[model samples]
Target: MRLNQYIAHHTKYSRREADKLIESGRVNIEKTKATLQSVLQEGASVFIDGKRIVPKEQFTCIVYHKQKGELVSKSDERGRRVIYDSLESRFKHFVYVGRLDFASEGLLILTDSTPVAKALMESHLERTYLIKIDGEVTKEMINAMEEGLVSEDARVGGHSKSEIVAMEFAAFAYYEILKNDKKYSKLKVSITEGKNRELRRFFGVFGREVLDLRRIAYGFVNLNALPCGKKRYFTKEEYKSLHTFLKEHSTKESKKIESRH
Candidate 1:
């Protein structure tokens, strides 16, 4: 783990705070000042403000059912309500996994463990969503979903301010067309990658506007029975499954590092 990540996972300090501490020379590894690029090795002595940071044996994870009109952010410049406003004060410091966009809603994963959050978000775990769109579901759209798409001008449905103009969409893991008509369509779709505005952009290629989007699941986590705006801790079985996934993920990452060396 990097120094900032180490501080974030082992202590209450966030990654940004850890960076600041390191920059200010308050963080030391083996009595030597640590830099942002410093990588932590097992049994290495790490200290901040003259005290050792002992890694916590356990971490907390939770799922929040985000509702439409809520931004997945800590704050908004335009004064719109953010997820933090709906979350309890105790969870104020927890980091959200992936975003749910302002108009989208449903299950959102959050955790106090930075490593866990980073791992899950970067993983190619399946994300399933329920989406409603304008116009009928066409054969071309189905072909794109099945064969994947590469758009050089994918800015159509993306945020106007987004700099991304090109995007590569992976083939959807699964999709079911629940409804179809000249005026509207609805579907359940699953994809592995979580590119920015991916689903919207894909539909934009077919000139269909996404009317509603709600993420129902990510990997093994689901939003079952979780009311909008409500939050809950992971069940024991969920925790067990998560730990298993994390262990496997960590092993794979370590192997990649070893291979690179």
Candidate 2:
């Protein structure tokens, strides 16, 4: 793999950030300063800013019920509130699998296995949200959303400007009109792609403002009764189940290495 990608998979940094680190001489490959275009061979050693790098043996996953106002990042220069502050001291290094915007609260997955995090984030894992919009929902609006609409503000790959890609509505998702509440409506939304401000943008297409948005579930994992701003370690069975699921879906490189005859 490319050295920057390898660093990203093994460390807390993103791939783009890893490139910057390499360019700045903060990363070393086999005790030598790494270049931005370095290619890493199997079994090659790596280090970041003099810290020895080692792949995780046993992976750990956790579900965190994030609360509003908590930033979903490892560090912030602006001194903003962050979710890492709420994690146990021993789990301070775990990477978040996906992010929930600071204003939005919901179930977030954290894991020690970078490969697993990469897989879950890059594969467009399904996420379900319970959203409250500040406007009445009409049948026409619901049908239009179900049929998918394009947003003029959507951008692809940071360069190509186009309409927002329409996501398929899950079967159980629908809008609920509240009694005596003429201005607000609640909806259960399920989406596969985790784009920036996706649910809000989806509703924006219909001219409805999102008053509140909370993720209810991710994959087979659900927040259930977990309260906001709290976290729980994954049960042994839950951990095993995730590993088994990953193993089943893993590609050749991610599987156990086998010897050739």
Q: Which residue segments of model 2 deviate by more than 4 Å?
A: 1-55, 154-181, 252-261
The residue-level lDDT of candidate 1 at 152 comes to: 91
* Pairs in steric clash, model 1: none
Give the least accurate 10-residue stretch of model 1, judged by summed lDDT.
1-10
TM-score of each: 0.86, 0.67
Clashing pairs in 2: none
- Please give the lDDT score for candidate 1: 0.91
Q: Write down the TM-score for model 2.
A: 0.67
The candidate that achieves the highest TM-score relative to the unseen native structure:
1
lDDT at position 121, candidate 1: 94
Q: What's model 2's lDDT at 158?
A: 20
**Location of the lowest summed lDDT over 10 successive residues in candidate 2:** 153-162
* Top of the candidates by lDDT: 1
**What RMSD value applies to candidate 1?**
3.3
* lDDT score of residue 205 within candidate 1: 82
lDDT of 2 by residue, 14-78 (tens): 77898888888888888778996576878988988888778655777889999998999987899
